[model samples]
Target: MVSERAAQVLVASNRGPVTYAFREDGTLDARRGGGGLVSGLSAIGTDADALWVCAALGDGDREAVRRGVAEPGVRMLDIDATVHADAYNGIANSVLWFVHHMLYQTPLEPVFDAQFRRQWDAYRTYNRAFADALAAESAPGAVVMIQDYHLALAPGMLRELRPDLRIGHFSHTPWAPPEYFRMLPDDVAEELVRGMLGADRLGFLTWRWASAFMQCAGNVAEDGRIVSSAPDDPRPRIRHSPTGESAFRTTLVGVHGLGAEAGFLRRRSHELDVEERMVALRDQVGGEGDRKTIVRVDRTELSKNIVRGLLAFRTLLDERPEWRERVVHVAFAYPSRQDLPVYRDYTAEVARLSEEINAQYGTPGWTPVVLHVKDDFARSLAAYRIADVALVNPIRDGMNLVAKEIPVVSDAGCALVLSREAGAYEELGDEAIVVNPYDVTGTAAALHQALTMPDGERAERTKRLAAAATALPPQQWFLEQLHALEALGEGGEEADDLGRT
Candidate 1:
């Protein structure tokens, strides 16, 4: 049981540990949180007092929520459906999201207006709900950790209620540079910057992202100073928590472990309609059996560089005739943000390229490319299990866990063709075939090399990959943060009371 006397650490984010679903009978079902959420929280262990407070996704969430089973000190606050719709579906996902990912079209340009303001109000309301909950729940001098861009305003909001609270906020996404961040209205940007500044410590995934945040702070702050920096160097005193799995296991079980989607992946993969998908692919490509199945799975987003990847595959088919009989690319691109015209257009282009490649190089026995547009995690895991080569080439990612996940779950000794730009390159680069995301010919050559690598070498690489992927599992990720928080608490008051600079 959590007591008021126990030291508390509250983690606030957009999504919580439980999601609600309405059944046929209209009763609600609550499911445990998946992916990074599970991993990070589990790592904290039982010794430390921690609570994960997150917004309820829907009205069903309140009915579905399993009161106390999720974890220690976990709380799910129910907000209005409109609050989530405008804040998450509107401002956060559609607007600020594209800004951070650099997914906007320069020709069309992004505009902020009354609609944005209304949505921004909802965003504020949602964040405040979490802030109010944390303020009430947190003990004096408690350490409050906020996660991701969705709750950027929560730190300050929480701080207002508990000035003595030791606060920290961590950004999981890539921070946009000053130029890209300037797209937001001046007041909105200022609010975001000041909101995050409420934290005593700020965390980012990489130094590059940290630098970007500092640059944005410089641009928006009144006196051109962030965290009391010199006028010429107006930057925040931010910390880089380049989270990773343990160096020993190659799995995310220990130091770097985020959490296991393995069971989820395995269970889900068994039922997904991949056989029908395989049949459709064969029919579309004219039943080609001798071709290589080069598989790529991603949400259809701008940063994924799906169009460029398809162009590279096309280049390979054009330049190398031998590959024509030996290669088939299976692209499982799930639709994301269809309401956004830019995303809709990008999805169309990906489909157009897939057709052109098949028409140009495909024969009755071999369709050079097969593209499936739907969200199917199980089919994706199944593909990972059998893929001879896995291509994950993102333009810029904080950490593409797929680069790590594929190699762990792959049954065969799969070769990884990764983008140099992906954050996972820091860990998997030694074993992966690195390529420039923009270079079509280069990526094709990498694909060829991955396909042709010696059997002994491939096995060696896979062994190393499996070791790396499981090294630091999800529990470790959470525990490390808790440990850091505890250390701060132990030393914080003494330093403060002493007035040590």
Candidate 2:
């Protein structure tokens, strides 16, 4: 295994910093990731250098070719395809993600068995692949920041290899309550918690998730000492820093926010054929500006409650006959985890419900529900821009970025109907129309209220929605965590990296 010496900071995730694409001429290009990852790095600034290690997702990566403009100091580690599949499709995304998202059925047995053990070994190997690459690449005294559940076991695995590194692990997803987490096999549960404790610090998206981690540590550690311990110490410090941005301070308002590649998402929008499609759609369905467009976009994942959202939309149309002709619900569900039977079935159910609704209320000139089950970012952005009401109802989520992202770019100033169960609710609760995710009737009523809201009230609410999404920006979120890490300087090398604007 070839290893590089080390650096100041390290980032490890399932997907690498850049994705590779091969061209006809045998040239390659890389596209960076979206969301908080990009935002976080930009916030790291020029002075702070980070070594980012992630698995390459395609053939271009397997061939060890780079496409597009590669960023400085980003290292890509490509793992074997079988190891990737067993670790990702078998364990992390399917098992751990389902557990953390509370997407599984309590009635069905979700136990760790021989097959699970085999996958567990693969999972360990998968994590070790990244850990090995990181250990080789890291500089002594580097702050190793491992991301999400995909590499939950990487912290301990990496620590075993490089004890000198100051490690930190952040969970982007919600941490399940201990009771729910205890479903895992004894060794699996114990090892996973111990794996995370190998870090010097642990970060979570919300205080609720942080509390859950502490509770799990209390149950699994036996020693009640989960968060902190001294050098030769086996435990790490735990902290909760729910991210937020001030709407008044965004680029739109000339205030600094986590500067995203807004230019990128903006340029990508024009390629989607969304504008042309929207015009055709309006002429076909709206009939001279008659229909209100309600948009909901999500990956067809279990926690998204896509099926429930569709049911509510159908119910709303049934309850309010007048809206059957006047409201068009555009549900853009991007396919996710088709390998998982539950996700596959749920996605099919979404399609079935949409078909049922449209069949019940379709006119030769109009369709009540337009459902798109493919992943297309440009179409999503375009949908966001036109939405009169944006429905974001997650059964459970770490944070619903869509709740924040849509309002920032919504051309029509959409009213957000958010689920109280989502972590984003903590920030958007006041401005949004909150509803219980499972209560289809209540959700239906909320949709009705949102669609029928007076223009003056809707405009006021839209302003608040936009404000909440922009407040923290991705750049600020990353800085807050970095500031926290800086405060915990190696044995009193402390300096206030906090109070950064």
Winning model by TM-score: 2
Stretches of candidate 1 off by over 4 Å are 1-7, 45-49, 62-74, 222-224, 227-291, 339-341, 490-501
lDDT of 2 by residue, 192-306 (tens): 8878766666777666676677777657645433322111223233321112422110000011123234444556555648787666556645757868988998998889998
Give the distance in Å from residue 357's predicted Cα in candidate 1 to where it truly belongs.
2.9
lDDT of each: 0.71, 0.74
Report the error of model 1 at residue 459, Å.
Answer: 3.0
Candidate 1, lDDT over the whole model: 0.71
TM-score of each: 0.81, 0.86
Q: Best by lDDT, which number?
A: 2
| Alpha-carbon deviation at 99 in model 1, angstroms | 2.1
* Sliding window of 10 residues with minimal summed lDDT for model 2: 247-256
Clash number for each model: 38, 16
Per-residue lDDT tens digits for candidate 1, residues 358-427, read 8888777677777889776666776676667888888877767777777777666788899987767767
